[model samples]
Each structure stands twice: as C-alpha cells, then as structure tokens.
Target chain A: MGDKTVLYDAHMKLNAKMAPFAGFEMPIQYTSIKEEVIAVRENVGVFDVSHMGEFFAEGPEAIKFIDNMMTNDFMGADLYKAVYSPLCRENGTVIDDFIAYKIGTERVLICVNASNIDKDYSWFESHVTEFDCQLSNHSSNYSLLAIQGPRSEEVLKQIEIYPTGDFPYYSAKEIQAHGEKLIIARTGYTGEDGFELFCSNQFITTLWDKLLNAGVIPCGLAARDVLRLEVGYPLYGHEIHDDVTPLDSALKWTVKFSKNNFIGKEALENYTPKYRLVKLSLDKGIPREGYPILNEEHETIGKVCSGTMSIISGKGIALCHVEKAKFPKDKKLFIQIRKNIVPANYHTKPFITGGHK
Target chain B: MSNVPENLFYTVDHEWIKIDGDIATIGITDFAQKALGDIVFVELPDVGESYSVNDTFGVVESIKSVSDLLIPVAGEVLERNDDLEDTPELCNESPFDNAWMLKIKMTNAEDKSSLLDATKYTAHCEASH
Candidate 1:
C-alpha cells in the first residue's frame, strides 16, 4: 500500500481505478482514459492533483537563493507570474523541473514533482548556507485541483472566487471561496486554459464536491498524462531525468545564460548536446516507452521516452531522443513493434495547437 | 463483478473459448478488457498460422498499456476478426460477441480439459484482484 491523498474516499466513491504513482495511491481513471481526454479537449475536466509537492521560500535572500538554484530568469518577473524552470545537477543534467510562483518580493512558492519532495527539500536546505532564507515543506498541508479545458472559465465563473476573466495566463492570486482562503493559479499540465487551486484539505474537498455538482468531469492521472503529452509538454521522469540535460530535452529556452552565476551554468554553457528530442507519428501501431526507434537504414538509433495515441488526431505519437546528425537527413523513422516495424514521420511538436495561450 | 458467461470455457490468462465440433472461437474475457481499459488497437494473427497452446499470437493495445494475446488451445487459425483492426473498442464495448478475436480449427480437442470453467475462472479473477 502507498500513501493516499486527501481525496481518497471521494475517488473510491466515484469508482475510480486507483493506482500507485510517485508513492501515492491516486486515481488513474474514473470512467475511461479516452473519455476523460475527450472531455478535457472538447469540454471541461477536473483533476485531483493534491499529491504534488509544495515548498515555501521566504527571507531577505530568497530571490538570490532561487536565482542560483534555477535556470530561468526571475530577476524582473512580476508578482503572481509563474516561471517554468529546471533544477540541474553540477553536470547540467536535470534533477527535476518545476514551476515557481513569485507570490511576494521576498517570498516564493515552488511546486515540485510529488516523488521529488524529500530530495528537493534536502537540496534546497543544503544550498541555503550562503543565503539567509527559510524553506518550509507544506506539501502535506495542501490539496490541489486542476480545472481545465476550453470551458474552464465557464466552470470557474460559477464559483466566483475571483474575476476569472481578468486572470491572465501563468498568473496566480489569493482568493476566498466558501469562506476559505485559497490560492488560484492560471496554470496547468494539460494544454487547455485552466486554473490550479491550492487550499487546505477540507477546502479542497468542498471545492471538488462543488465542481462536481456544477458538472465538471472528474479526470484522473491517466488523462492528465495524455493531455500533457498531446501538447508536447514534458513530464519530469519521462522526458527529463537525472541523465538527460535540459538541452537534450528541448528545454533550452528555459535556461537563461545571461544570469551572472547559477548552479550548472558553467557545465551547461560548455556542454554540447548530441541527441535531440523529436516527435513521430504512426498511423497504425501504438508506440510505447522503451520501444526501439530505427532510422531509415533499419538501424536502432534511439529509444522512445514517452508515447501515446492522440485522442484528437487518432495517430500514434511519441517523443524520442535520436542522434541529431541522423534525424531530418534520414527523413524516415520506424518504431519496432513486436515483430513488425511500422513507419512513422517526424513532425513539429505541439501536435495539436491553439488550445492554450 | 466481471461478466463471466456460463457456457464459455476460460483460461488462467483471462481468455474465453467457445467450442463447436472441431472449431473454437477465442477472445479475451470481459474481465481482461476491463482491466486493460479502453482498447485502442488489436493486432490479429494471420488466418493460416498454426499455434501451440499458450503461444502469444497477437497484441491488444490500450491507451495506457499493451497486453499480449495468448492462445489457450492448440489450433490452426481459420479466420481473423478484421473488424477489430478498425474498431478496437469493440473489445471493451462487447468483448464476448462482436470482439471475438479468432476462429480456429482445433488440433487437439482434448486441450479443452486443461481449461477452467466459468465458476473457477470467476473465482480466479476475483482472487487475482
């Protein structure tokens, strides 16, 4: 058995298929992954993302501490605007990728992957020797709900927590709902326009019930993974890992070299990437993780990191790390299914666009 | 509770078989389809292929995972369900009837004795979960 989230009973009541993910027994699907994916793309869906980790950093030196640890430029970032960045090792390889919200000038809230809470906290603590900052792990005290889709604003408007229309993308604010204080952020893993709500366990449960009563589809992690992959978003363990650097993961844009000094800056500046992440689509076979990707000569050149059949396009899509020199020039890629090699074509990412701003 | 039809014979691998003379129709049980979630693709064996008992003949792909289709009885594949190639959700929508995977001519009719009955299979499914 694994740790259960605050909404465990609610998921069980909905007959959700519970599975262990990142040390938490969370819901994988309530009805079906296909239906939930469709709901989020065409309509609206809600996900209990309470298992993710949250850390609060505050003090006079918080900004300096964050700038040293992160690769993104947060120097002139506005309050309530979240910045996506990667935490790297000394060798420029990724430790984890996260979103940081600058709630105040001297205070920031960092959302880490659920599985990396302990590791990330320890890393933060070890790096705070030079800076006078306080780090607090409030992961257990908060529950998150991601209300996502084209009609997400319609669902959020009914709650009246804040003026949903005024909140811009990648922004957050403190609001009150049901007489309870909550943090509402206009960000999500799904490519749909949505908000991620952070609040106390009791308040989260209440909000979940309210959203369900208002006709929001209750989605699970399976649909969430598919939705993110459809939009060419990277998951921590899948696309980026301890061995894969941000450069190889197509996240070089998140790394700003203009900063004076930061962790992994020297290594990243000197290192050259040999493998490039590419997207491939197949019409018949569904490619999966660890499947060997073959070049035009039928030689195994790389492996698939993440893959799925796009519910919107009905084509098998995968993200693979291939040798930079062999791709585009080779022009053709094939995924080796059990006995057959199915042909696939390299395509530009965000396979289906225009869903998110 | 998963739907386990009374007359069909079952395998420990969660495949169901219906016997008629020397012919046997085979497909994954409803319990298997539900466990696999929404089936998106089904790779069928060729109609003329011969397989021994317990041979992996094809595959069923779901959005989240893929499972191999194991043959329960020794037989020669007589016909394949080409319809499933286009609409694989038939396995989830109607596993017992419309999603029948293959029709086979049995090489050894006595192989049926090795399979489990509906009661035992239902108990097996419940126990495994």
Candidate 2:
C-alpha cells in the first residue's frame, strides 16, 4: 500500500470505495458521483483533499522570492486577494500551476498539486539559496478541506469560529474555525463558489464530522472531474506537463512580463506557443485523456488532456491541445471514442461558477 | 442496502438474470451500479446483434472511466433501453427497475444453475470488501 491520508480511517469507516491515485489510497466516491455532482451544483458538499501539497515560506525576502517565482501581479492586488500563477522552467516550459497567497512581507503559503510536489520543491531549493527565504514543505502535517457549492457560505456561518467574509473570487483570509486556525480561501479547481480550508491534520477529522452533522455531503474525485470539465479547468498531467508551457495551456493572461526578472522570464518572452489549448464539447461520446484528435483532413493534430460529461452542461466535454496556427475555436473535430468516431465542437470557456461565494 | 432479489440469478461479474419460461431479462446488479458510480453514457447493441456467453457487448461510460457491459449468456438481443440515450444516470438511481439492459431468449435456461442466489451473492460481496 502507498502512503495513506489522515482521513483513511474515516473513509474505511464509511465504507468508501478506495482507489489508488497520485500514490495514495483515496476515496473515489462515497455515495455516488452523480449524487455528489448534483449536491455540489445544487446544495453543498465537502471534500478531503489532504493528498495535495502545501508549503509555508517565511523570511524578510519571502515576498521577493515568492513574487519572483510566479507570473502574476499578486503584489499589487488587495491584501486578501489570491492569484493563480504558473511555476516555470528556465526555458519557459511550465513546471506546475498553483495558487500563491501572501500573508505578509515575510510570510506566504503555496498550494500545489500532489504529483508535482517533489519537482516543485527541488526547483525552489535550487534558486532559494540566493533569496534569503526559509521554505518548509508542510504537506504531511496539514490537511485541506474544500467546502463548496450554493450553500457553502451558510454552512460556514454556522461555525462560530469561521469569520464571515464576502470576499470575491481569488480572495482569501486567515480565520479561526472551531477553536483552530485556518486559512480559508475562496478558491477551487471545480469552477464552483467554494472555500478551500488549510488546517492541521489533528482537527481535520473533527471538522469533517461537524460538516457531516451540518448535512453537507461528502464528494470524491469522480464528481470533481466533471465539475472541472464543465468549467473547462485544465488538469496538470492531462493538459500540461514539463514540456507544456502556460502559454500553451491557455493561461497567457496569468503571465506578467513587466515583473522583475525571474527564473523563466527570458524563455517565456522569446518563445511562442506551438499548440493552443481549446475547450471541446463532444456530441458523439465521452472524450478521454490520450484520445487522439483528427484534423479536417483526418490528420493527427493533438491529444485530449482531460475529459468528462459536464453535469451542468449535460454534454461530454474535453480540454485539448491543437496546432496553434491551424487551431480554430469554432472548428469541429472527430474524437476517436472507442470503435466509432464522433464529432466535437470547440470554444474558449471561462473558469467561473454560478453561485456566489 | 442488501436487496438482491432472491428469485433472480446473479453472476460473478455483478450481472442479474431472470429466467421466465424460455426468455430471460438481463441487467447489471445494484452492486454494479454502486461500483460504477454515475453512468453518463451508454452504448447499446443493435436489435439484430447476436453474441455468445462472455462476448463483449457495448460500453457504459462513467465520468471517471469506461467499462464494457459484457453479455453473461448466449442469446440474441431483443431490445435496448432507449431511455439511457438521454438519461444514463438511471442506472445509479434505479438499477433494478429502469436500468435493465436487454431481454434475451435463453438457449439453455437450465444452464442458469451456475450463477449465484441472493444469499451467496451477498456473501461474495461481503468477503471481497
């Protein structure tokens, strides 16, 4: 068995169907994916995301070091505003995508995907020696809980320790919840109005029980995929990797060239994207990762990075990479779905939710 | 949650078959639906499609993965659930009532003895878990 999460016993106690993912035994679904998807869309749901990576960086140079590593203009934003940034290679290829929250000049917390934790840590260690920042990987000691959907705010309000905030998307605040400190960020990967709480593992189980008592449903990775696909969020391993740049991942707006010189600035400025990522809605069948895309002339152009049946849209959708010059957002492509070929329409979709956070 | 019909014959692969005279109605069990999670797409076989026992039929696509709905008995397809074309989640909500795949006329109905009953099937799932 791989490393287990702090909530492993809770999952087993609830008879959750465990599946191996990202080198961890995670709950694929507790009740059902459809029910969980509907709950998150219509009501409220909570997820155990302790498998993700979290790090705390502090020092006088933490601001300079952290700001230099990202490609967004977070330094100029409001105090509680969160910024999505792409960590990059020296040659402009994106290493990973993450959210960087600035607590103070000497303190910042970075949340990253689990698969890229080691690689990202090594990347930081290489250049951090010159920045005078103290970086610590606190992934093992912490557990993350995402409370999402239309009723999330109401549920959070019931907890006396949770501070009431009307912060807009990409905003966060440090608060005390249930007699414990938490960093509640109004951010999520599922394109929903939700709060991602970073708290200690010691209290995560108790927090989970409290949420369950509040009638919030427990959702798993199955519904999370559909929600993200409906909003056209690009997953790391599917639509991005070491070779893919943020520019190719359709996140060019997140890159700021005007910022001070950073590790990958030179390569990003000189390089142009070869394939542009596009959102596709499948009419024929369920699109999947690694599924090949056929051009108008039946030529192999790109591959699907992530795909699912959009619960909100009621259609099969996928995020794909296609040749930049030849890519047409309005064009149609034939996706090889099993033994048959089905048609798909392409467009540029935003990553936003319907409910207010 | 243990509601497998005692009269119906079940398969190791989580398929349920009901024998009535010479005809049989086949479908994936409730346990199968719980395991498959949300069923978003269903690929049904044609009415004229014929297959032997263990022959690969069509596919059932969930949000996370796609798996084939294998045929458990040798027979010809009599009908396909047309409702699943637009409402695939019926498999998860009501697997026993509305999620039946097809009705086939069994070639040898007595061969059903190899399958399990409700008591045996429940024990099988409990041990596996």
Candidate 3:
C-alpha cells in the first residue's frame, strides 16, 4: 500500500474500482472504459490525476537554470505557454519527461512523473548549483484534475471564476474555483482539447462535485490508457527510460542540440541511434507491451511498448520500439502476442487528431 | 435465466461444457463475456488438435485483454467455431449459445466431476468478486 491522494476517498465514494499505479491507489475505471472514452471524445470527462508530481523553480536564476536543464526552449516561447521536453542525462539519455510552464517572473512550474518526484528533486539539487533557483516539491499539497474533451471549454465556462475561457493548446493561466486559486492549463495526455487544474488538495472534493454537477463525466485510468494509446502519447516507463536516448525513443526533436550546455549534450552530439519508436497496426493479433517484435521472417527486432484495440478504427493498434534498420515503412513486423504471431505494419501514430469540427 | 443448462459442467476459468452423450460442446459462460466486455478475436484450436488438462488450447481476444481459454479435460478438438472468425463479437453478444468455441471428443468422462455445477459456479464467481 502506498500514499493515497486527497481524491482517493472521493473516488471510492463514487464506486471507482481502485488499482495501484505509481505507488498510489487510483481508479482504473468508474464505468465501462468504452463509455468513458466516448465521453472524452464527444463530451467532457473529468479525471483525478493527483498522482502526477509538481515542482516549482523560483529565483532570480530560475529562467537560466531550467533553460539549461530541459531540451526545449523555454524563454523563447510565449508566456502562459507549456512545452513538453525531456530532462536528459549528460549522455543524452532521457532521465524523464516533463512539462514546463512559465507562470511569472523567473518562476516556472514543472510537472513530472509521480515515480520520479524524489529522483528529479535530488537531481536538481545536486547539479543545479550555478543557478540561484530554489526548487520545491509541491506534489503532496496539490490535487490534479483534467477536464478533457471537445466540450471542455464549454464546461469550463460554467465554473464562475474561469472567465477568460479561451486558452490555446499548451498554454496556462491562473483562475479561481470555489474561492481557491487554481492553475488551469490547456494541456493533456490524451491529445484532446482540454484543461488541467492544479488545485489545493483540500478543495478536490468540491471541485470534483462541481464539475460532475455541471455534467462533466468522470473517467479513470482505463480510459486514460486507451485515450493516450489512440494518440500515441508515450508513458514514462513504457516507451522510454533512463537508458533510452532521445534519438532512440523517436524524441530527437525534443532535444534542442544548439541550446547552451546541458547534461547529456556531449553524448547526444556523437550519438547514433540504432532504434526508433514506431507505431504499428496489427493485422492479426492484439499487440501488447513487452510482446516481442520480429521482422517479416521472424527475426527479433524490438518489442511492443503499448497496445490496445481501437474502437474508432475497429482494428488492433500498438506502439513498438524497434530497430530503425528493420522498421522502415515498407517492412512488416510480427508481434508475438500470446500463442500467435500477429503481423504488423509500421505506420505513423496520432491515429485520431482531435479538436476537429 | 440466460442459458446455464442444469446438466452442463462449468470451470472457474469461465469455460462451460455440455456433454452430449460423449462429445462436449464447449463455450464461454455468459458471465465471462460480460466481464471481458467486448470480444474482438477468437483463436480456436484446429480440429484434431489434442490437449491435456490445463493445456493452452486457444486464445480469446477482447477489446482490452487477451485471455487463454484452457482445456479442462484431455480431449481432441472435434470441430472449431467458424462463424467467430468473421463475427468475433459473437463471443461477447452470445457467449453461451452462438459463441460456442469448439466441439471436443472427450478422453475421460470422469474428469467432468472436477468441474463445478451451475449452483457452485455462480457461488464461486460471487465470492471471488
């Protein structure tokens, strides 16, 4: 058993079937995963995402410090904007993936994977001596909620304090909900048009009730997994790891090579990756994580990172980590999925681009 | 009220077998389908394939996970379900009736005694949940 978030009791009250994830007990699904997924695609669905970790970097040198830590350009991007970037080791291997938000003067809010909170904090404290930024882990004091879907904006307007209703994707702003200031960001893991709320832990129940009363459906991790897979969003440990380089993980674009000296820059400069992440649609089997990937002739290539049945496509889909040499678009792979060798075709991900009229 | 015929034997793994004289018509329990949610694919063992008790006979692919439908008794597959190849959802829509996975030629009738009766199977499921 691990620590429970403030929303744990609320979820159990709603009859959410809880499962352990990142050491926290969270809801796997409140209802059928299909219905929850449909709710997000067509209407609005609220998710309790308190398990993700939040950290704050504030000081005179916070800007300069974070700019060197992450691969993506921070100061160059506009205010109220967020960028997905990988914090790398000096050898260019991604230590973790994170989202950086510029909230105010020399201050930035970073959301990291729940499992890496302590590790990331220690890393920052050890290596970040030159910069005057003070890093604080604020994960335990906050409750995270995601109101995601095409109609998320409409539902948001129902909340009295969110008057500046329109936020471009990847942007964030502060708003009040139930008299508590909340950090609202137009960012999501499901690749949908939505807002993520970082609010006080004590206010979760009121906020959840308010959203549900406003007709926003409540979803859980089951729908979250399927939704992320549909859009090919990578998970922290699933598709990448500390040993996985940005180029090898198909995240080369996330690494800004020309940026001033950062960890992992030297290793990345002369790095030659042998593998790349590729999306595959299995023609025969249900591809799953850890399933061995093979070339057409049954030669071992790589392994499946994530897989699921696509309700919208009526087909089996998967994201695989495969040797770049063997996973060209013209090549076919066999995913060994439990007593079956399902054929897979290398294809581009983001199977469904949301926010369409 | 849905067809859990009084005579059929049930396995905890959700497979049910109806013994017609000696041959057994095998399929998943209706309870299994509801729990699995949606069936997208079924990998039925080919006819003439023989298996021992607890052998992995085939696979049932659902919308979320793949389950290994095990063999309760040592037997040879007499016939495979052909309709499921085209309409996999039959397993979900009608697990007890239209979604029969295979017909098996029994190797030992005594092995059937180890399986649970309808009353016992339902009790087992209820307690597990």
Candidate 4:
C-alpha cells in the first residue's frame, strides 16, 4: 500500500484500476485507455493528479532565487504567468522539469513531478542561504484535478466557477468555489486546452464530483500518457532523467543561456549533447521504451525514450534519442520490435495536434 | 464480470480453447482482453508452425504493454487469423469468436485433461482478482 491521495476513495467508487505510480497509489484506468483517451480528445475528461508536488517560495528574493536555481529566467516573468524550466545539477544533467507560476512579486508557486518531490525540495532548501526567501513543501496540503479536452470550457461553465476575466493560457487565477478557495490555472499536460484546479483536500472530492456529474469522463494515467505522447511531450522518467541533460532531451528551449549565471550555466555552455531526441513514425509495430533504434546498416545507434501507438493517428509514434553523430541521413530508421525489425520514418512534427483551442 | 462461455476450455494464463476432433481453436479469454485494455497490435504465428504446450507462439500488444500469447496444447498450426493483422481490436471486441488466433492439429489429445472448465475458470479469475 503506497500513499493514497484524497481522491483515492473517489477512484475506487468509480471502479478505477489502481496502480502504483511514483510511490502513490493512483488510478491507471477506469474503463479502458482507448476509451478514456478518445473521450478527452473528442469531448471532455477529468484526471485526479493530486500526487503531483507543490512548493512555495516566498520572500523578497523569491524571483532571484528561482531564476538562479532553474535553467530558465523567471525574473522578468509577469505576475500570474507560468514559466516552464528544467532544474539541472551542477553537471548540466536534468534533475526535473517543472512549471513555476509567479503568483505575486514576493511569492512563486512551483509544481513538480511527484517522483522528484523529496530531492527537489532538498535541493531548493540547500540553496536558500544566500536569498531572503522561505521554501515550503506544500505537497500534501493540496489536491490537484485536471479537466482537459476540447469541451473543457463548457464543463467549467456548467460548474459556475469559470473565471470571468482574462484567464489566458499559462495563466493562474485564485477563485472561490462553494465557499472554498481554489487556484485555477489554464495549463495542462495532455496537449489540450484545459484548467487545473488546486484546492484544499476537503474541497477536492466535491470538485471531482461536480466535474463527473457535468458529464466529464474520468480518465487515468494510461490515457494521459498516450495523449501527451501523441503531441510529442516528454515524460520525466522516459525522456529526461538524472543522466539525461536538457540539450539531449530536446528541451533546450527551456534553458535560457542568456541568463546570468544559473546553476548549470557554465556546464551547459560547454556541454555537447551525446544523443539527440527525435520523433519517428512506425507503420508496423508499436515502439516501446529502451527498444533498439537501428540505422540502415542495422547498427544500434540509440534507444527509444518514450514510445506509444497513437490511437488518434492509428500508427506508432516515438521520441527516441539517437547518437548525435549517427543520426539517420535519409530519414529512414528501424525499431527492433521483439523478433522483427520494423521500418520507421523520421518526423520533425508531432503525430497529432489538437485541444489547443 | 467478463464473458466466459461455457463451451470453451480455459488455461490459468487466461487463454480459451475449443476442441473439435483433433483440431483446437485458441484465443485470449474475454477477461484477459478486458484486463489488457485495448489491443492495438497482434502478432500471429504462421500456418504449419509447431509448438509445445506453454510455448510462447505470438504476441499481443495493447495500449499499455505487451503480453505473450501462450500455446495451450502441443500441435502444428493449421491456420492463422489473417484479419488481426489489419484489425487487432477484434481481440477486444470478439475474443472468443472472430479473434480465434490459431487452429492447430493436436499431437496429443490428452492435453485437454489439464484444461479447466468454465466453472473452475470463473473461480480462478475471482481468486486472482
């Protein structure tokens, strides 16, 4: 039995197939991965993502503290705006990638991956000596729910809590629902236009019930994985990890090299990527993580990082890191699937794109 | 509850088999298909292929993970399901009928003695769950 979220009982009542993820007992699926995925793509779906970690950095030097610690520059970000960044070690390897929302001049809220909560908190705590800021781990104090898809706005309207003012993309707003304080963010992981709600644990069950009653399909982690992969999003454990740098993981855009002296600035400036992450489309077999990526000569050049069959495209798509020097020339790649080597075509764009409305 | 037809024999690995004379038809049970979520790809053995009991003959790839299709009886494959190559989702929609993966001529008819009836198979699924 792992750590159960506040929505654990709600998931059980919905007949969710519970599985362990990042040391938390979470829902893997309710009815089926395909069904849930389609519902989110064509209609609306809700996901209980309360296992994600949340932390607060508050004080006078909060902006400076965040800008220096992450690879991205957060000092110039506007209030209520979110910035995506990869937290790197001194050696330029990624610790984790997270989103930082500038809630106020003296306060910034950071949302991080659940698996890296402990390490990230310690890393932040160890660096606050020079800054006049306080770092607090509020992971257990809040619950998160992501309402995603094309029809997400309709569901929010049905709940009667949709923000009235300018709630642009990647923006956060604090609102009240049913006399409870709730933080609503126009951000999501499924490459969909959606809102993520963060509220006290006591209020989450009610919010979940409201979303479900409003005809939002209950989705789980499996569907979320496929949805993100269809749009070429990187998962932490699959695409980026302690041994993989942002440059190698195709996340160099998140690293602002112009920033004055971040944690991995010097190392990242001199570092050359060993492997370059690229997308591939397969017509034969589904590619999986750690599958051998071969060249025309059948030589193992690299390995798949994140791969799945996109039900939307009806084909296999993958994000794999190939040796920078051994990258395919003719756009021909082969994924060694079980006993057969299946041919693939290299693609620069995502397999499917939608829900950005 | 999953559909477990009374006429078919079952294995502990969640495969359902139907025997007629010396020929045996094999497929994953409805319980197995439901557990696998959606079947995205299916790898079938070629006709005239031979296998022993419990041998991994093919593969079934779902949206979540891959599972090996195990042969329940020793036999030579007489026919293979060609429709699965184009539409693998039949495994989820009709696991017992159209999704029958292979038709093998049994080398030893006594293999049926080790299979379980529907009532016993239902008990096995309940206990495992």
Q: Model 3, range A1-357, lDDT digits (tens) per residue? A: 778988888888888878898899988888778788889988899999999999888999886788888877876778788889888888777778999888776778899988898888887777668888888889999889999999998887887646374477888776666678889888898778888899998888888888999999989988898898888888878887877887887787788877877678888889888788888886665777889998877888899888887766667788778887776466667788765777776676476777632
**How many angstroms is residue B105 displaced in model 4 relative to the true structure, after the best TM-score fit?**
1.3
Clashing pairs in 1: none
Point out where model 1 deviates above 4 Å: A163-165
Give the per-residue Cα lDDT of candidate 3 at A245: 83
Predicted model with the maximum TM-score = 4
DockQ winner, 2 or 4: 4
Per residue, candidate 2 scores C-alpha lDDT tens digits across A103-209 of: 56677889999888899988877878887789999999999999889888779778653556566777777887667888888888776678888889998988889
Model 3 vs truth, CA RMSD: 2.2
- lDDT of candidate 3 over B25-117, digit per residue (tens): 888988787777667888887899998888988888776678888998778999988999878889878877798888989899887889899
Task: State which candidate, 1 or 2, has the greater lDDT.
Answer: 1
Candidate 4: which docking quality band? high
* Best first by DockQ, ranked: 1, 4, 2, 3
In model 4, the runs with Cα more than 4 Å from the true position are none
Better of 3 and 4 by DockQ: 4
Q: Which residue pairs in candidate 4 collide?
A: none
User: What alpha-carbon RMSD in Å does predicted model 1 have with respect to the real structure?
Assistant: 1.5
lDDT of each: 0.89, 0.81, 0.83, 0.91
DockQ category of candidate 3:
acceptable
Two-way TM-score contest, 1 vs 3, winner: 1
DockQ of each: 0.90, 0.73, 0.48, 0.89
Per residue, candidate 4 scores C-alpha lDDT tens digits across A1-357 of: 899999999999989999999999999999988889999889999999999999999999998999999998798778888888999999999999998888889988899999999999999999988999999999999999999999998889888867788877888877777899888888888888988888999899888989988999999999999999999989899999999899998889888988888999999999999988999989888999999999989999999998888989999889998999998778678999887898888888888886674
